[model samples]
Target: MAGQPTYMLGNRNKSSRTRDAQSINILAGKAVAKAVRTTLGPKGMDKMLVDSLGDIVITNDGATILREMDIEHPAAKMVVEVAKTQDDEVGDGTTTAAVLTGELLAKAEELIEKGVHPTIIASGYRMAAEKATEILKTITIDISRDDRKTMGKLVKTSLTGKGAGEYKDFFADLVIDAVLSVAEETEDGIQVDVGDVTIEKREGGSVLDTELVPGLIVDKERVRPNMPKKVENAKIMLASFGIEFHKIEKSAEIKITSPDQMQMFVDQEERMVKEMVDKIIASGANVVFCQKAIDDLAQYYLEKAGIYACRRIKKSDLQKLAKATGATLFQDVTDIRPEDLGSAELVEERDISGAKMTFLTGCKEEKTASLILHGSTTHIVDSLKSALNDALCVIGVALEDQKIVAGGGSPEIELALRLSEYAATLKGREQLAVSKFAEALEIIPQTLAENAGLDPIDKIIELRSQHEKGNKNAGLDVYTGKIVNMLENNVLEPLRIKTQALNAATEATVMILRIDDVVAAGSRKGAMPPGMPQPDMEM
Candidate 1:
């Protein structure tokens, strides 16, 4: 017993393992939050995220910023997911979700410090979130989808902080028209699909040149120079397969015995191409948009037929064209019929930015729409594209839900005020956690004020007072540095943005709080989370 040496299992001990993983997770969440917090409000700053490869991104969009940075911390990536979820689900409010989650974690960190368990804090925060959403439903106003003026305001609000702020009026009008063009009235409610709206960016024009096309556009030209540049009352044939020989599926060698046989083989291939073109012509399709290439011989025949054809069209473009023109996508040229052709008043190939692009216009009944975005610099165009996309998604959601809420941080203030009242009704430490959740909600308005260079505390006090008086619409008017009614001022957002942001932020915060350890894959060295100490390093 005295001579035996002790053995170690995996060279691990409780002291060697990372302690305070939950604390580290919360800090990482907060760090990610602070990184994007300044980009929250209309006056928020843009983040210049440079990746490991030295690629640069200058953006105020939260989801874009988080995505661009090379994040390594597992908990930090969870924070990033908050942004992605908010962006994917609501199209706006990624910054709000990230900031709220960070603030929630910060507040919960304090509750943990006070000896309250993480689960208790999570449940309390959950309760506060539910209460906040209920208050939101009460305060939101019904927005009639047919009311263009009000709907335009909803879009303008979305575009306010983005680089497109200067062109809000023009862009808002364009966005609403695009949304309404694609929206359909169903038996249950109005349904909108954002994919129905396509955005095309081109240089050499100002933002003012941006216009809405009622149909679709593809950045492709007529396959041959001899093809007609324009076709009137076009009967369109959309094909997913190439028009040449219909595709053989496999390659083979055709050996010729003599010059005469080679000539015959060539003639046979030409005749086959001619027959395929004849079939399309018999179907009465004067225009063709092929998702695949058109053979040179087939293009020649198509040109001879005076057909306007665009080859190598994207699958998405083909589908939208079908929707816009009532076109049927053909896999077989043999089954062509007049009934399969889609009608567009005009199919024209136009030179845009030195490239040939085709436009299918005059389909007034079709639900597909296109937005042509123009700007002098790629940066401005890229930023405008993002803003316009957000604007469209927000309006679409608003129209679908038939409900809207005041933006400019008014809703958060109202939710905070209501949540605080709800928190007061609870007993014990859970009440404190709920109250902390309410305060976390206030971070939105505070950030709005801070980003505007206004006094955050004064803004919060004024907003809280206004909310107390049943003026639920009262919110920080960052542009004016005053407390005003967001609805009266025409600053509005979709109700889902606020509700979804809170839902995502709370879920993420709770998830981070619930984690007690993080074991990385192939972790060879004893793990020590950032800000936690290693015994050897301390020595």
Candidate 2:
């Protein structure tokens, strides 16, 4: 019998595999990154991404765009991951990290094709990154503790045009202080607890005060004169949602076949309602915060009894309100509070066209301790809460540990350039990765050109020519509609967030690239990906 033999492409036999995983990752990462990067600098244009649901989101925010898009490629997934990591590390800066990383991989691909080993490139990249970090440190100015001016600028940037108006100055100081207070003062940068607190707009107005109350606020006084007139030192309590507790035999109404039985059920219900309210009053709870579900009888009795009750309290806003007023929550009225009470001016809901509820209790107008609401719509607010929560999780990280970078994109750019510069200095072909890194640095500018709809090729050539002629600071310059020198004048530098993001994205990408294959610990066939060398042993 004649046996057929198979030949392998490049350097492999039929049974042998090469770790082209890095190549694929780098390629995919760079391609998508390139597409996104083109939208950088002032020249960057907006992208309108419409999801399957026809929800259209338009922005150059890389994480947002990538997140909303229907991305499928595994490598592209990694690129998105880079953006995600950037976003996770800092509230802003995902785009720059993705852009820089994609360019790095792109340049690395060229070097790899030219015979540079992936390991060599990785090592050089590592060196360049370290150098970049050092250079960035030199440029970073510490935000003075008292320099409220710059701090105010950062806050204003976060709050302005978001319906914050003259309130910007007021809320800016509040937000900055709250962030600073939550975050530790360190040489690296100010740490902040970056969670999104709920803000609601209602028909009632808002109140600003720090005095803690021990009871609920009701629109009317207690229905009965016998009901205590505002129990002094009332213990305030909250509930998950509003509901009256009344026990009934299983299917009691079904068995009741006569009017007398029905009347008994009604009377029992009334009695239960009264008992719960009386218990709350007896517990010395002068106030209660609950969702709008008070039984009519309970409401009538509570009003006559003089309990301060605020109904329809948003579930989300309860936490901050609780924190601000020192109120405790109870599922049943029996668990009322005297010490849990807090005070707020009458709960007035403001009907701003968009969303406009600014709930501040126990803090002066100029003082910090305010919530900034993003994504004003009901759905958008929910989504924004999740996004802001992710941001907050990152803040938790800051709370738990000292972060390495203060700013995001600017630091990332600085780091990328240094890594590339160091690669240029390496002694041998190993320097290929370093040089590649430097080449990757071009991605930022290249992306800017792409986003601006300008000729990236031409801009690169122009920048290169200037650099070769002795322009030390040769980089991409993007403007609204044209390619301009970033160094030319008055170009707003990337935010501090990008720096931290770059480090995280770079690390994650490199880790994924360095691995030939991912092993599934427990599964049939060991969960090995195709076209990569499997681990010597499977778990």
Candidate 3:
């Protein structure tokens, strides 16, 4: 009994050690990569994802596809994380990151089969990733924020390969305008918060009907019919407190034993409501956006005062209003002062698609903007919004970093060439990993060519030849199937997209490769409760 080895894990626990674990994990990672590989470039196809509830989402956006997938394997989930990280950091290139991660794992599998250690492969990947990043920085082209032409190209590049591609030029101008309108300059550099740019979508019109608002749009209307439908030179007050009577915090009951006493109580409530409305008027606020309820009495009084009021506004919308109009949000009406009010050129209630919405345009300060997108169906509008968001993010990233690179898979080809050269200078088996990393990068161009119905091998050969001939920007044109200079063709993206994708892919791959063991506890799904009878399986 003393010499008997004790089981380190629970009886219900299952574990795969070393080679078995690595094999299973690597295969899972590769499978996930293959799932989204086809959704790669401009010529990529969309995937129709249906959830358990029967809702469907069709898109080529890698982030969306992987997110909608119900993945079970832990290693496969890591690949999905790569796409998510890319999307969060750069707002684009999710597919590229995912595909790259799969390729890296594929290569690592080869190394593992050849008796190479996972640690050695991971170290080589780290070195290759660092070298690839350096290579990317060397190839980036600097552009001034004032160069709208180049900025538009960057936006259009992100918009391509989706439903929005057909209207890229139109959407590009709108995205750039919206981003620059809210762009701020600080000690650090140009900072662009895409959150300041709101996107509102509606059905019933064509995508061309999309327009950018220089300020904000609230999906609400005036609280009362008699109130002014429009207010010029608006002084807006954002109130978190409701105009309704304040309720007691603790549970209590009032004893109104007589009709006279009940009337008196009602009169007192009216006075309180009037006083609350008076405070808002005294602040020189002709327009009120309340985050909570507005009483009937308060509404009547506000309408009589000719103030445009909207009740039950969302807290997020109120904050955006504060930013757009330079207004301060006041939780207590008594604390509101003339200085706390925000100014807008005009506040108007407009009927859009038979529904009333408030539009606040020409803010005192251009700190926020909005885009109203129109499409024939809800699905179309959603896809358009997704594409526009990606475009907006890439533009913001480009403005913040002021660096761009040729798109159309040009950067990947260039990175592959430079990394291969860098690998040559390294010694030992790590160089094999480095070279594999280089080869893995070529998967982008190959996938792009394959999706476009072109010969992937021929295209890669041509691209490599062009790069070797000093044509670093040469990329395959998915439309014409010709190798051309992406920079000259006006195909470009922010350098951040490529860097973020590479870092995320490498990190995910290295993590999956270093795994030597996997332990899974028995699922508790149908397990009987303690002391409960187990279901009979004899039948």
Give a tens-digit lDDT track for model 2, residues 248-279: 55765468889999999788877877887787
Report model 2's TM-score to 2 decimal places: 0.67
lDDT of 3: 0.89
Error of 2 at 88 (Å): 2.9
lDDT against true structure, model 2: 0.52
lDDT of 3 by residue, 437-484 (tens): 999999999999999999999999999999999998999999999999
Candidates' C-alpha lDDT? 0.85, 0.52, 0.89
Once fitted onto the true fold, the runs of candidate 1 whose alpha carbons sit more than 4 angstroms away are 1-19, 49-56, 245-257, 334-337, 523-539
Query: Tell me, what's the RMSD of every candidate?
Result: 4.2, 8.4, 4.0
Q: Please give, for residues 20-55, the per-residue lDDT of candidate 1 as tens digits.
A: 777778888999999999999889998776777876
Q: Candidate 2 — number of clashing residue pairs?
A: 57
Compare the candidates by lDDT and give the number of the best one.
3
Q: How accurate is candidate 1 locally (lDDT)?
A: 0.85
**How big is the RMSD of model 2?**
8.4
